[model samples]
Target: MGLRHKKASAGGGHSTSGISPNSTNGTSGTSPDISENRPSWRRDPLEYNLDRSWDINAAPTTRVFNLTSSEIQAAPDGVLRPLFVINGQFPGPLIRVNQGDRVLVNVTNQLSNGTSMHWHGFYQNGTNWMDGTVGITQCAIPPGESFLYDFTVKQFGTYWYHSHFSSQYTDGLVGPFIVHSPEESKIQEMYDYDQVVLLQDYYHDLSAALLPGYLSSGNENAEPLPDNGLIQGTNFFNCSSYDSDSGYACDQNSTRAIFNVAQGKRYRFRLINTGAFGEFQVSIDNHTIQVIEADSTLVHPVTVNRLPIHVAQRYSILFHANQTTTNYWFRARMNDYCFSDQNPVLDTDVRALITYTNSTSDPAPTESVDWTYALDTACEDLAPSSLIPYDPLPAPQVDITYPIEISFQIGDFALDKAYINSTTWVPPAIPTLNQAVAGLQVNNANFTTSGVSTAFDSSQLVIDVPTYKVIDVLINSLDEGAHPFHLHGHQFWIMASGAHGAFNWNSYPTLNMTNPMRRDTITVDAFGWALIRFKADNPGLWALHCHISWHMEAGLLMQFQTRNDIMRGWAVPSDVLALCHVK
Candidate 1:
């Protein structure tokens, strides 16, 4: 286990017996009456039409090589302003499958550049080849080639897939992969109403939303271009202003998701933040939200003053509507870009807004019982325990317990937001790139793609098979903003984070608890450090870095792996494995 000290936001309000993300004012607010008067919004208006069929010749595609936003939407007003996209769609189609279903994802690459698809958080059990681990798992899918992706759905939850070979993920190569329930996904869990919003950000021009552009192509002196790293993929009819026939002049990568809800009903809103860079304190037309689920696992259900979702993470919430006649405009108006730059052009953050149907004004709030908050619980915090027995195999094991300090030197408001690791990381897309950019060095090793393995080399998502245990990861901030640090696969407990200029190690409530907020990803406050711990349990390559879509694409990633578990008897069936040419 890697045990390290992290900085934390010490004294925030807890959810238990308190205000959940669902209601803003809390117990004092009047609750909604579910007795009678069912309006149309109470009938679950948010329905997603998802269809899954067999496509024979589709490989991993990236649009950065040629196409622009204009080609995808095909309308002067329809353009989504995508920088890097696959199939010209941001957050690709919602792929539907069932458990135990052997699916064929025929990927057809359209870009001139090579790319690969990595199904984020998809436990590649028997089909190791399907893991898409980039260098370790398979080679990049070249342009104009077709790669047959065959794998069975083993787990169910809200997961996604995107390009790992390049920065295509930030552009829009990824999409939702929904593993339907055994009932064929017919049993719709309606809260009277439902909604889904995928929060994303795009650079004005060549932010991570597009490929490397000229800058990332090893061009250090390239001229910077305009870019706004803020965006959400689809357009909707809520607080988002759009010209029905003739639209307003918004940025190139702007689209809004709209939800029309009637008053006095329970509404389920699934919130997924896939933005390149933007941590939000989301508000839905001033309505508080009850956060029921995180990532894919069900939490104890905590209400929050804000629906704070970073990149590559998902949260499901229940909203109890209190009105029905008027338009209740919901908005995730971006609170602050943690990486804010003075240049407003490049800071076109993707703000979220939802329009609801409101009824006669009672101004009466809803009283909510059955509310739960706090991530640390008995079930979620527990490690993977085997109800069944298992056989073991030989593997390397190294336990490390050293202090690794990572400093984030905060800069001025305008320049500080542009936190690219290197001048190269800015790509040519950055307008007036940060020239005195510090070289990316991880564990004090200067990272280089030349294969000499730099200290900042995110080369390995995993440390070679149980090679190092007891690793200490410490990210310190020399500034005053918050930064979220995420580790893949393994959820680490926050040992300590500095808030109020000191570490409340002993006073920290959930440090050693029977129930801890079991999370694989967590946000580190701006200008602070966050320490997390995790067991090197899972044996595969994994990434440790910022969940911010733009950050990872900008070289803020490192990898390690645990190989002690070779997965005995976990072999692909002869028939299924034969799909590939064995020579």
Candidate 2:
């Protein structure tokens, strides 16, 4: 299977005025699109081992990416239908390692279509060449070919990886990559249990997959209905489905989806939001998640019943399931409200199960469960910098990190249309999204963006910004939905965010220089705006946008170029730049 250039799709296209529709009317139902009622996803696992190789051609095929679920699925179900997985799982696989350990992921694309992998939120460090960005840092490895991604695991905490080229992640192509603290040997005795719980939303209506086809087709009607929430892949209880094909009822539950736990143990729940475009509020049987880390950076522990995460963000929480009973139910939910909508009554709550004990019930339906994982405490501090291998260089000019107004003035989703530089935005033979990457508003109003990626020249930037140079950004959305904007290679502190150009910068606590949590992504409110900042340190072309694949494929992205160390000079490798094949 091959990656095709953007073209007209059966789903829909983008239009210049507003969201237009083709086959999907944003409403799907034998009845009216049920905004209140929803679905039950399967219990699944997102796990995998890092496959390493110096020789790409000789890479071993031990199924590097393992989607810990126990479901039976076949890839390329028909002709070019990709299964949204690398090795038979929604989230491609899990990559785990110890701090300071060298990491190498020999990606082998065995599925039916062409794809590219992203090391989401991972500090590219000295290995800027390995940071995954299709058609920019490097081109997608063609089918029948493989690539060896080698890098050292410098930072510890929670991180993830996903598909970068297209919206395959929406169909379920994602996974977790964990780097344990070098201090793990000492911290091991602090807890008696450890488990990873990742959350993600899915679009199971296979035939209706949209947005992506519209990248080139410009058809808005083809866009699938907005699917707002999701549960952990491994939490939904085993629900039996009835198949009339053979006039029989059998258990169709995936074997790899079930989880086992003990009654008394101090467990660590590595919480993640892999939502291509959703924010989730997680709960676990009425228990508050004692959060230990944010975006993989350790912080003073904080506790809360619920904490929200945008696309590509991660959290680590600790809990003691020391319940007297043998079983305890756990749940996680994604709300309809984001910076955009702030209150989308139309959004549904997503649910999943977590059992503290496997003991069975006496064949009777029973109680309700409500719980969420969150930070236990917080402090003013900055994470100690790891010994990144890059040479120290001079910093770039930090001109005005001034605020920019957002205007979702692009094309309509229902009609294949758009505008670039105030003119109609047309798809390039090889599309370059820069022209359409500014001031995106989703629903024909003043809105904010979570974050979007664009490109910039090394020459046009301000160098060596003085200390305390604050950059304020105003994102406006044109669409009715929210977008989680993430910045590659850097972390920004939140200033403020709200729908319709509203913000509370003076009221919110400013991130202190001490104990600052490094993050890669921050979600913009639905039809809202987000105010965030970070020291412009890293020098490279970075992407900023919603983690949601479909929105990105549409146009919710842009770029930034920062020179943290000016003396280091432009270190992007020669061969890696060639890989991008930029004319």
Candidate 3:
């Protein structure tokens, strides 16, 4: 099945409105009139929530969203720089829909560079071209052009959309995409309010300006450090930290994000880490949070004082407003131990205000005490074994095993690059999907291979599944840094993971096949290994790569061509094909 483009205008579907602070009982009341004339960075908190009158059991309808990408100057953390924003918002607007609803997003690229929008964690089963991956699915939406991303969301949980071209998303161009389902009715009752909490590692310079240095010879594997951390795209940065002649436009008027909650009400905060490099250890002072979902996979509630979240990963936690009516600190501390080098001007501890009375005052140190538990010293995800899927679904028996090793090497010109089994991926001139469909339709032998395909150049790592089967991917990281790997179009059951060493063949039979944590993104610890299994049921060219903006740009990516029997019949939409031929 190919993607369908609708010719209707961009404003008819359910649109979001601002949340009124005067509302009681956690239900939104009298939405404030929001328009383009308002401050660009200001977003309505209610825009992130499912409408109170929305009927979860109602029929799914097509939701149309319009986004304009442009370059603007803004100081998310006191440092002014050129940023790529959607609809003038640093963090893009929310695209909320119900499960099975067709989502049509019109992305108008006004920047001088090419761009594409990847809906993170969506199973773009039949509409693979709409996956919006630059190299694996389709070409980038060229400068001053528009592309309509059309796909139906099959899963319901917290997901996001971001630019898939190079490190463009690091500069901005990211936002939340949420899908609600009737199946969530039971979980909905557990909370009276719902909102999104965006956590990102902020950089003072544009990613385009920093890329050359990181990719320069002799630089080794030292990733550029973040200047600050942000909560909801805003944070307090001390302008005095910069020298008077530092050449930066620092504004001391910047402030931290504040989230207000009513007493005795439970709120669900869906946290998404949209950063380039840093992993955040998130916590709310005096609040013991319960994690209900991870990477769009709902799980049995796991309570913890702090949450360790890596790049591109998401978690939804339930927080109860049972404490005193006062402001408390919500902390997202970057794991500096994971950084290869220290940044002197960086404040690793990023904070936001969580108030019960809508007071914006900073919490007194003695009023809100942090949990005594030590932060995570290692860069990795929360243990997979500790989280069990809410719905018990046994993993299918594995039919094959594919082992791949990852490492960063300084080769040739002494420039550093990442590799997956001796192959460092670079975007092919034509997307892999285009090449596969064209070759498969003509019965080319190179495209029909069961293992790795030779239809593309050496830089393209293409593993062809070709048929339906259950597969286990053993990902062993040889480098000394944690990597959060995201698999497009599918969520896998994490059979086993370790901080160090190889998968034990002796322990293979003892693995948990029933109800293991299933998620779209997982962090393989530094020099660690992870064995994940998934059924090769989705027909398309699916990308499996590290979600870190730096790592991915360094050639750490691969694609799986699954179920060619169905893909062989695809006819890519003309609009998607037109992007490649743009002058």
Candidate 4:
């Protein structure tokens, strides 16, 4: 119930060399040691050969992964920083499972702090306790305590997993989560090779070290700018850029990640923005990326020279290696507008290499041109119209509508915090899910089905739905900053969005019922409003909040307790029940 930190010494004790024992060793059968496949200057492609395609109704295949959470002295961008790693890797190992498979991740906390792993974009339907959202679904896995995350993968495509407790993930507790389905098998024929490219904004300090300064009074919500950016956990940074007196040990020899491509072959690059903040404009010079998937939605291929991806968003792009045998920059440029505070060592332009040769030696720089299109001036999502899911499924009619407003408030004593309507979230001693189940069994008067909350805990806004209902959420952003709002346990259809003042109720009947962009995370631009609709059929408590680590920590979150009729008699597992009892 309390935020924990493992104090990291501020000297030159970090190293970015060597492979972790838990990393994948480029082999089949038992779980591979993921660090063995860590991206190097001239490493081969990280294969997506794991079996993920299966019949939807077939008996669920159980897959187990041993995830060890520990502290690591890592330099993701050559600047030493303390990272909360998983299985000894900076950007944790990938978890690939079939759409209908049961994923049991046994997580042992070796760090000196509590942690919980949220399966980003996973709909934990019948097993909401496994949603892994600390204080929302269950308590954090206590330090030295082990917890089993058991959930079924209902949806498929490029998704991710990260620490959902406080700002822990920003310090390096993030990784790729790919769910392959029958639909992906049909799309796989379009490309010969599949790989993952992680783009992140790097900081030289632990998030715990930065939180106090950020949360202090009078800061005015100015976000901490990153020291650098990374491509697949590696990038080049000049040691001389930071003064020796600056207190950061910079290694000038740190290498950038390299992807060796065979000429004339087509490759599918799954790009995941796992950074705490910073929307990256990803581009590989002289190459046109044909985007075939957005988040977990498989879409009709849309081509672009550059793709602007916000936090927690994923895109699968296909590109042909038909160019001349030379090295080209694979860029993931962190949007400068996202940073209010600047860092002298920060190079917003993050780059990696795409080489035709297998040599680790640096290749001769070749001339490459960026597309002529103007860059996006606003931090918004890629247009919803451009992405149409290949398998068109019409959105169901809304049974009820909830018009909510999200804003930031400078509370008493000038402390800045975010709010969803009147409730500014603070972690409950017992999860809302646990509270709801207990309340429902006793028929607590505060609990209701499908309407406004009746609970009086101003900090915990619980939307109680006794039965299944189709809900429409019209989200209005009262703040000046754009927020990437993500919903747990379900993907919603983007019915309508506008940068204008409000959602005109007059246009309700004219909304699109045909297939719209259905994704788990969406952005509501500054002073903008977006109407999203989803069927609240998933049975359990789900957290809907901004994906920004800073904002979420500042109380920008709310929960929905759906299908309480099914939850009243249910009981949370003993292992999960035990986490709350730890001191």
Candidate 5:
């Protein structure tokens, strides 16, 4: 992986890697000295523009955007810090493109370090190289380099893009992506307005600065607890929580994010947990939330007062403003049960103001109360069986079953790292994708016909399918902490999951063939198991890994090479191949 290097120069001169956003090399690097030397291909970051008025039935077209990644000075929740943003905006631009359209997003790396973006839930079927995974598919885009991610929107629903590098997204490299289609017309009528709600656990310090200590040998998987939480890039933090000598600037009167609602209107809130860790229970005082979508799959509406959302998961809820004209609290509570310890400055209950009037100055009602349902001690997702996809597509029959045992063990150096079965993943100099393409094209012996190939390094646990096959993956978690496993290219049908000892093979034939919950990310409870199945119709290297930023860095990831018959003829584009020469 090209992720271990640092800036070539510490005492900043003209950076070959590109200038920081807050440095003398301003937003566009307009200075006379650097202008001529700057790459003309580099462009500014894109601005988010999502118009609800746009016709969902409009003809599909190409959507082009230029995104520049750089450092910026900002206060997401009134805590001033250096944030990595796109176009100088926190929580990068929202990408909205209609279904069946082509999206050409050119990303320019202006940060002093390298980074790559992963489209959270898109099945990059034919365009696997454009999946933007830092190591498994391609190397990290070098500093000051540009990579054009050209892919077609094959599915319609709520999705997101974020830096897939080690703990990079934890620092603030995230934004929402929405794909519209004519199928949304019926659901569009169910809500008066639509909005994107982002709920994340906020940290005052950059993740890069904290990585060293967290990875130290003596640490026992004790993750750094969040100092606060944010709802859509803003929140209220108590300035007095830190003393004057604490070296942190604080504002006592920090404002909270406010959403104004008209009386009797139903608003659809697209909730995404972009946080690296922490599961949240989100709700509005006195309002019943009707969940219609989960990870882009529209579900039959189910009403609840509070909804539990884990890391890398999403849900769209409809709430009607049937209460009286007044201000109410929209609360997001971080479930601290999952953390080994708590931070002194952390206020686990994060709230925003939901006002009926345009004047956000209206004070929220103090008498508001949280829902009576108690938060669970275990970190998990909402029950999968409870959600039924509106479209009702049943899962196909399984052709192959891969039973992966997930556990953690101290390596030879006494450093704890996650392992899938006997092998733990570390990025190779040449990506698995590049290696597969070259080997398959030559009809190498490693490209076996039996659906399992050992062509990659021994440290990687890879399953190779030379042809299309339906896969049943039994992820057995042997660790104490719960894991949210996210598959890169396809949404799998979650056959079943629980904190049981192990999956009974006798129940395999008895599994339901009717509609089951299908999503890209699913949580496997501690010392438990989950059986998920997906059609391995996509061609390319797809990663199945724990979504927790820390767990992923601990080597808790594996890859699947599907449809090698199709990949054998792939001619990897020149620009994608250029990244391997970064060092």
Candidate 6:
């Protein structure tokens, strides 16, 4: 069946806030009025909490979400700027659904520019067009138009949705997506409450406004440093850092997000790092958390005082509220060392309040003590080897290997560009999937190959896997900065990773095949390499790229044309193709 955007009923000028009441299964609940422009700090944290009463045992049904993209002037921190919000909320609204449910999101674009929504970590098996990746599966939903993203969520856990068009998500278009399942019943019992904790690096300027300087010549390693960091879309920014006439509307009354819990309860905080550039070291004063899930994969409980989370990565930790009935600090320290340079006005310490019931006062300096463990100097994710999957699924033997080298080089104009091998990606006028399907249907030899495809231009780096096979991808980084690499559509087994050195061809036989932390995102440290394997059974064109927004805009992305044998029989959706017709 074909999918199309249903027009809003006449006389109702599209409600710009809240999920549709007609949604089946469970709705994320009502969101605050976006037109009010109230800062997140003043709003109750419970309003942002996910409703835990969703019936997990209910039969699968379609869950509908109406999301409108528009620009609004607001201050996530204390500094005011124009933010692209969904349903008028900064950290968009929550989308919670059961594992087998179908998700139909009608994304209405009211912004001046085009936009698309990507359900991060969801494998769009037969519905590649629903992937919502601009330049890959489909084109952007042009201004004043809407697109229906219909897909079934086959996996369960914490996921998120964001504007896959350019660096728009960094400007505010982000929200949490949680998939519940009967399989999680055992894990669910350990927590008395569940909620999402968003961590992001806050910038005073819009990403579009900062792109020109970052992409200019002689700025190879310089990424725009954030002015501050945020937890649940709120943080206190010292306005004095900006000059009296700095042309910024600063409000010193901004406060930190407060998460209230009972003294002897357990909380499942699903942490999602939605920032454009910074990696955060997360911790709660005087509390050690048990990490139960990593990137949609349930893992054996691992206790740690502090958690290092890179951009686009997620971790669900269980926090036991066994402390005294008092407020404590919930810290998310931005790892500024990862940036080539720092903003003088930037505050690396980002905090929120973990207050007990009936306690509203802030924690005094001497009252709450942070974890004494030394901070992480390395800009990388927690060791992959340390997190073992709860379910033991041995990785299959590899059938082929593709070694890709990633680096940043100053090109002909002395402009910095990221490269995978010798190719740098520039979004084609037509998506790679559109090109691949047509070529495969015509029985083009180039499109039916087992390696790279020559059917597309040099700007598109596509590796074609014509049939089902266990593939190994060795990603080696040549740059000095650590990168968090995310692969779309599939969660691969992390065979091995190193902070330095090449993947030893001799060590292939000894690599861990006993469920080696299968995840969708991983960090390849500075001058490091990662070996990942996945079965090419899913039919579609998928992207593999750096999750860092600036780095991606610089061209650190590639596509995998998988299961072309199956894609050849597919027909492009008319509604999806319509997006490309817009100017």
Model 1's alpha-carbon lDDT is 0.42
Q: Could you tell me how far off, in angstroms, the CA of residue 490 lies in candidate 2 after the best superposition? A: 1.0
TM-score of 2: 0.66
Model 4, residue 477: distance off in Å is 1.0
- From the highest lDDT down, the ranking of the candidates is 3, 6, 5, 4, 2, 1
Model 2 worst lDDT window (10 residues) = 19-28
For 316-355, candidate 3 gives per-residue lDDT tens digits of 9999999988889999999887776678899999998888
**How many residue pairs collide in each prediction?**
94, 117, 0, 8, 0, 0
Off by over 4 Å in 3: 1-38
Better by lDDT, candidate 6 or 3 = 3
Q: What TM-scores do the predictions have? A: 0.61, 0.66, 0.94, 0.90, 0.90, 0.93
lDDT of 2 by residue, 457-514 (tens): 2211112221224344455544444455677766665544554456655654442333
Once fitted onto the true fold, the runs of candidate 1 whose alpha carbons sit more than 4 angstroms away are: 1-90, 98-103, 126-129, 152-154, 180-190, 208-232, 235-256, 345-403, 407-462, 465-481, 493-510, 564-583
> lDDT for model 2, on a 0 to 1 scale?
0.45
Q: Which ten residues in a row have the lowest lDDT in candidate 1?
A: 429-438
Alpha carbon lDDT of residue 54, candidate 3?
A: 56
On lDDT, the candidate that comes out on top is: 3
Which of the predicted structures, 4 or 6, would earn the higher lDDT when compared with the native?
Answer: 6
Which model, 2 or 5, shows the larger TM-score?
A: 5
TM-score of candidate 4 versus the correct structure, residues matched by position:
0.90
Across residues 378-474, which tens digit of lDDT does each residue of candidate 1 receive? Answer: 1011121100111121122224432333333233331222232321122121111010011221222232222213332332222333333544355
Cα lDDT for residue 287, candidate 4: 87
Which residue pairs collide in model 3, if any? none
For model 6, how does the per-residue alpha-carbon lDDT over 306-419 read when each residue is reduced to its tens digit?
999999999999988888777789899988666666578998989987777444467977778899998887887888888999988999999999999999899888998989
Cα RMSD (angstroms) for every candidate in the order listed: 13.7, 14.0, 6.6, 7.1, 9.0, 7.3
| Shift in Å, residue 317, candidate 3 | 0.5
Quote the lDDT for 442 in model 1: 20
Candidate 6 Cα lDDT to native: 0.84
Clashes of 5: 0
